[model samples]
Target: MKNVLILGASGSIATLVTRNLIEDSRVRLTLLVRNPDHLADDIRYDSRVTIVVADVVKDTAHLTAAMQGQDLVYANLYGANLKQQAQAVVSAMTTAKVTRIIWISANGIYNEIPGRYGQWNAQMLGSTLTAYAAGAKIIENSRLQYTLVRPAWFSDKDLVSYELTQKGQPFKGTEVSRQSVASYLSALILDPSQAINQSIGISEPHTDGSKPSFY
Candidate 1:
């Protein structure tokens, strides 16, 4: 069985990933959320899930303890202090001797996105992108085997079709569904060889225009 620990388990994308993994009897999940009460009843009561209530930015001791024996760590987290939180997670993972991690970052972090859409995205989300960049750097420098996913502007679409661009390439397209992001991450957890030690940019194929379709 693969023991997985999901940080920020209550977030939208993480919730979707949780739903996808819960049905598999071979996967064991430990959900770390700031507020356990916010989790859906089905998730909170799932026999395969262990809910840990604590802040990822603080509560280092509890977080490290929860990381013990985990085969994989998926961090779907964001905030102004995202870099600090990522550092904490890395430290905890090191203490627990867990080496695999999948971290969610935003597109445009490298400022390699081309065209007017890229400009608009940078203008609107420059600060948050900067934080994400720093967070990604911390993970890259760590000893862990990490996959940093930089996803395009999110859509509420139900489809999972998407494309990938490697780091340093111009981020393709403007939008990808949240479900697609979750699905890709889930697949990586099941098979880590596809993109180990790489940063990938995810977007829906041919969705590129002047801006995201959802805008």
Candidate 2:
């Protein structure tokens, strides 16, 4: 069985990933959230799930302890202090001797997005993207084997179909379903070799436009 640690477990994407993984008998989960009370009873009570209530950014010691014996760490985290949080996770993982990680970042980080949607996204999320870019850099430079996922703007759609763009390629599309992102992350967790040590951009094929289709 694979022992997986999910940081920021209460977030929307992480919750979906958790649900998908728990259905598989081959995986064991450690859910690290800021508030255990926020989790659904089904997840809280699952036999294969272990809940750890602590902030990954401020609880380095606790995070390190939780990383012990885990095969992989998946972080679904973001915010102003994202770089610091990434640093904390890296330190803890190093201490725990865990070698693999899958981290979520946004599509605009590299300024490699094209067209009107890219211009708008950059103008709107410039500051946040700066921090995300820095955080991605931190993870990329770390000794751990890491896959940094840069996903397009999130959609509420349930579709799992998506496409990937390698590091140097322009990020395509204005939006991708949250479910698609979750599914991709879960697949990576199950088989980390597919995109090891790479920063990938994910989006739905031919959905490229000036803005998210839902808008």
TM-score of every candidate relative to the true structure: 0.97, 0.97
Model 2 steric clash pairs: none
- lDDT tens digits by residue: candidate 1, 1-215: 99999999998899999999999888999999998988888999988899998898779999999999999999999898988999999999999999999999999888878999889999889789899989999999999999999999999998999999999788999999999999999999888777889999999999887789867
* Candidate 2 lDDT over residue span 92-191, tens digit each: 9999999999999999888889889988888878789988998999999999999999998899986898999999998888889999999999999999
Worst 10 residues of 1 by lDDT: 206-215
lDDT of each: 0.92, 0.92
lDDT accuracy of residue 40 in candidate 1: 86
Q: Pairing residues by index, what is the TM-score of model 2?
A: 0.97
Candidate 1 C-alpha RMSD relative to the actual structure: 0.9
Stretches of model 2 off by over 4 angstroms after superposition = none
Q: After superposition, how far is residue 157 of candidate 1 from its true place, in Å?
A: 0.9
Off by over 4 Å in 1: none
Model 2 alpha-carbon miss at residue 158, Å: 2.2
